[model samples]
Target: MGSFEFLLDGIVRAFELIVTLNPYILSITGVSIKVSGTATLLAAMTAIPLAFALSFVQFRGRHAVITLVNTGMGLPPVFVGLFVFVMLVPAGPLGFLNRIFTPEAMIIAQYILITPIITGITLSAIKAVPEPIIETVYTLGGREKDVVLTTLLEARFGVITAVLAGLGRALAEVGAILIVGGNIAYTGSVGGIGEGLSYTRTLTTAITSETSKGDISTSIALGIILIAIYLFVNVAAGFFRRQD
Candidate 1:
């Protein structure tokens, strides 16, 4: 076939796969959402509280802590993956848990990778709160807890945006998960295709694997799904910012 014909054929096949909700594609997409979604939730929980503490409390080495968090925000995903891999490998410190190459391991790696991003953004959000607003809370017989709650409410939109940012990063990430997740699929075939449901195979890793195998249709389908996820996250973030 001509080049144009080949490209058109691949697009058609990709559309078919998506329209039919191909079992393999659906499974991989589900895994991607589950791992990234869980990681984003866990990171938000840890980050928002830490952000509030950093913003409200006075403590020694606070600058150092802030610096560390800021630095972590730009950490290389591959490095984070390597760090997690070392800690989870058979001879490594947390190896007894035997989580290496598991979905749990992927979650842990992604959490570590995105926690700082969320925390840093959340910290900025809280810091952006007007001092007078906080003072007003205190002036009205509000305790420290009340002040913190008030600040959080004021920055709720920014915090939500931070969470969405983290989710977008997690969804687009491939290197970290590849290192820790092993990107392995089952050996058997289904519907005359290799391995219907992947154990640790996510959309990003599956895209790489499919493209390498010269399965252009599958790769294109997965890429489309990934882009859709990223766009959704961005739109949500924008909506929250507008509300603010």
Candidate 2:
């Protein structure tokens, strides 16, 4: 009975915190969205062309490249973080960029983590496109670009699912972003209002912090929001699936 009452109290407090727009929670949520969205967009931009090339072009080492991409799908995030940190270190060749421990660094890490996923899934989608569709477009005297575009369009549903899968991976990730971004929250002025921002303190990070500190109410609230976001993504994916 005591445990049940405690759980009920925590739930009520969590809802209160969410409804009241707690700054720490809101800030973490904002950072998560920004980092995840930017990573997804950048990954898509790069992956789409790579997917097309892999699907339609024949060249030396093509099989090797595909194999590498497939392997990247299961990459360990902590290892990626360690590798990137080495390259971005002060003495490293490209260290002039000074991208470490910033939102930009977090985005970069996420891009690397998610790009392989995007590429692998996109390759699957493109390959799933009917061969007759490709040949039909080609036989109609369509340009190579036109045929590729048509193939992509025909596989649009699968492509969108691939993107969602990449996003799901990105949003749920922790290790890479935590390592590169340092999980430090920043405080400063935002449009004349005091605001806190963190390059790495995503919803997951916030939940971790809250749980460690025994802030069950806030942790529960953040968990709810995280679940809501995942549900929304799944719902959106379902809509696109139906469209395809």
Scored by TM-score, the top model is 1
Tens-place lDDT per residue, model 2, 1-244, is 4988877887898888678877777888889889988999999999888989988899999999999999999999999888777777778766799987777888888899889899999999898887898889989999899988898888887788778888889888889888878888777864232446555689877778778888777778888888888889889778867875
Model 1 misplacement above 4 A: 1-5, 234-244
Runs of candidate 2 exceeding 4 Å displacement: 187-199, 240-244
Residue 236 of model 2, lDDT score: 78
Models, CA RMSD each: 1.9, 3.1
lDDT of 1 at 165: 85
Q: What would you estimate as the lDDT of candidate 2?
A: 0.83
Which candidate leads the pack in lDDT? 1
Sliding window of 10 residues with minimal summed lDDT for model 2:
190-199
lDDT of 1 by residue, 1-244 (tens): 9989988888898889889888888889999999999999999999999988888788998889999999999999999999999999999999999999999999999999899999999998998999999999999999999998998899888888899889988998999999999998877775455776888899999999999999998898899988988888788778867876
